[model samples]
Target: MSLDTTTAMPTNGRPIPDPVPNDLTLPQSVDVVVIGAGIAGVCTALELAERGLKVALCEKGDVGAEQSSRNWGWVRLSHRDPREMPLMVESVRLWKGMNERTGAETGYRQCGITFSVTTDEALKEEEDWAQILQEYQIPARVLPAPEALNAFPGLTAPIKGALYNPHDGRAEPQKASPAIANAFRMLGGTVHQNCAVRTVETSGGKVSAVVTENGTIRCSSVVVAAGIWSRLFLGNLGIDLPMLKTTGTVLRTDPVPDGPEGTFKFQDYTFRRRLDGGYSISGPQTGLYEITPDSFWLAPKFFPALKSEFTRLKFRFGKRFVQEMKLPRKWGATDRTPFEDTRIYDPQPDTKAIDKVYAQLQAAYPAFQGVGIAQRWAGYIDVMPDIIPVVSSTEGVRGHIPGLFVASGLSGHGFGLGPGIGKLMADLVTGAVPVVDPSQYRLSRFSDGSKIAPMEGILRR
Candidate 1:
């Protein structure tokens, strides 16, 4: 659980050569060109390489520098869309066994996840989710407020009830990301960091080459897994992705005696079981967000429903922070950058937002009242209009674009289910029977009138 700052530096600076490739003048060809080095891209490349494919993984920033490393490391399946449940289950399995497979410490812990609830309606919803889990034979149960309090002796938040899932867990996103990327390299996959791929060449409706700042590299297949920047990468094909940006501002406090002693879970509105000894808490709230329409450069489609949602979220922040006077709260935004436009946005953590979050944290956790504040920052989570991932190929784009595949639109839920989606992508590419029905995630779902009805409490806030 130690935080090592050294591994993060490679994401910046000049382009580096692939570990296996010595000649720099763009390799003539590869079986697959995987774009973006985050969880989605790295997982996809690792899966593909495991299938014996020659894979090339590219990244514009440091590995996992974006949302991959900048997320709450909760690996739980409670309150997920029905369609995504299977993927979440499989991802949990992968996460549980990742350390053995990759030989890297990922800080994976099956400590389970708990959602503290204050209202009867929310409890009913939790019961409903329990039914869903029961049907799937997944271990889920409702823990009443008193029971939850007993589970976490020091949890002082006022709670009427809570939901617990024994099978769910957590992992260090920062550690897991690079571990998986390194696993991909061990599988003979080539990774190119700080190598911004610009244009992709297509002929007869298939991808023929991928053009980056360094030069053109021949590729039969391409996977655009560039988190929030996915739409920008596809813009060259005149395709406007219906992706949006959601911001999450998180902060860390100085290690405290009761740090890792609290519940190894998170409450719905605020709080998470930090792997680094101390608990990290946030208001049970989803922060600011914006959507992209038909153009990457176009103004965001501010979904009107979110305003009221933010209001309630603000109330939650105030309520939670009012009780805990020690925790600090930080805040910031996810950006809207095209792949070639990384220079257009700021990668630095938002200090202003961090200060705000610090104030909120101080009010929430008693142990955090006089604790020294540590690091804090923000990251963008890409959301779809329907708030689901778009995993199938680009529709109506012609024959395979040869190898141009899309596995994005995670809608802020990417980290938890990333490994499973990557495995699914590999199965499709390798002509293996898919583990789950991917039809639910087909790219056409958006335009084909198969919208994911918005979760009442999700989008509006």
Candidate 2:
């Protein structure tokens, strides 16, 4: 099948009004230059600006135009990787107070999250994951069959049990990064849209400045939060970042009352009630992994992860292979890069998979039988080998690029973990004490002979 490479701005379920305008003049110098205007970049800039540091956030396109807004908008911690639990714990706290801090409506609400299981084996998995939650003192409970059915009504299937996290929540992906960017501007931070950073300029083996498509911006430090483009950007610097992309398709329905209040994941279908009174739905175990040149090159490193997720991921080959082959990996600052060609990475939705999910949803809940599909869209998720994120500095890592930090490769958890990861990146960039231990997220784990693997649990998005 031919891939749809249409270069249009992503339709993020809801319309984002009154975007923060870009700074007309790029500052000659700033304390830090953050690449990519996704949630991670915006939040990092906000934290740094609040610390009285001059920071500039440069994006290839509009803020949150990519996976930041294209996600399922779930802010959950019920089934997190144990290594990321602490950071997620802190992230939920940050999310609760985000509206007051940013003075913007992020649409965050703690309506709770439910992972419904049908089989005895699946129930055991949730129970085991709940033990990890208990270790971290998280208040997630596993409801038995009868109680689970009572907690979530309209379920026609026989649910053995469910893992419930009352503190877990949902946020509007459409409004999150933009609101954070506006908040960053309020704190005296610079935001540059349509500005693609070609490469980082090094001075004495440290980041000195960045050459964007608009112009050069001198800075002492740089944070690479470029979501799917981080690997390519770092590749030009001779740094091998083991990152890959997977396409996630989602659809939203018109305002349909009588739906479940919180986010829910059944055997195959997953959904969350939108603030707009509609429901955002997708398949819990469905996504496409378009085979690219990187697939072969990074296969060895991603072997464990591939085996772990073999049941969920589907492999395909087509235009994505050719498009990635045509992407200029080692571009000079003067050359027009692919980032400029595709301002926003809006992939076509998997209509077949979406139809299957919608059918399953209606079959499970008769209330949704008449729900009308309002919109459907897809985005690429920047996945790391271990299916976790790397939020670390380059101080002691191999390649040891000083004055540089990265908070990318969030797998699919960037939206929920953005704020906490941003705070951690700020702490690393400013040489302040970090909020969580940063050893697990070091970039060298892939190269240092550490066994890279995903934690045992149902993958949550």
Off by over 4 Å in 2: 1-18, 457-461
TM-score of each: 0.82, 0.94
lDDT of 1 by residue, 1-461 (tens): 22325333222212111122222345678988888877888888888988898988877766777778777777778778777888888888788888888787877878767777777887888888888888889888998888866655455766778777877777777777788888888877777776677767887767788877666778888888888777656754566566756567665555676654323333433445655665444443446433222223332332433443555432222332232233211211122224544622233344455555556555654556666545555666777766678776765543235456788988777888888989988876666888888887777665555544556555421
Q: For residues 1-461, could you state the per-residue lDDT of candidate 2 as single tens digits?
A: 23323323233443342377788689999999999999899889999999999999999989988888888999988778878888998899999999999999998999888888888888888888778788878788899877766655767767888998888899999888999999999988989999999998989988899999999999999999999999998888888789999988898877788777877888788889998899889985458889999999998888877776677878899998998998888988898988899888778788778868988988888768877777777889999988889998765556778998898999988899999999999999998999999889989887888988877543532
Count of backbone clashes, every candidate in sequence: 33, 0
Task: Report the number of the highest-lDDT candidate.
Answer: 2
RMSD of each: 8.5, 3.4
Q: What is the C-alpha lDDT of each candidate?
A: 0.66, 0.85
Best by TM-score: 2
Output the worst ten-in-a-row residue range by lDDT, candidate 2.
Answer: 1-10
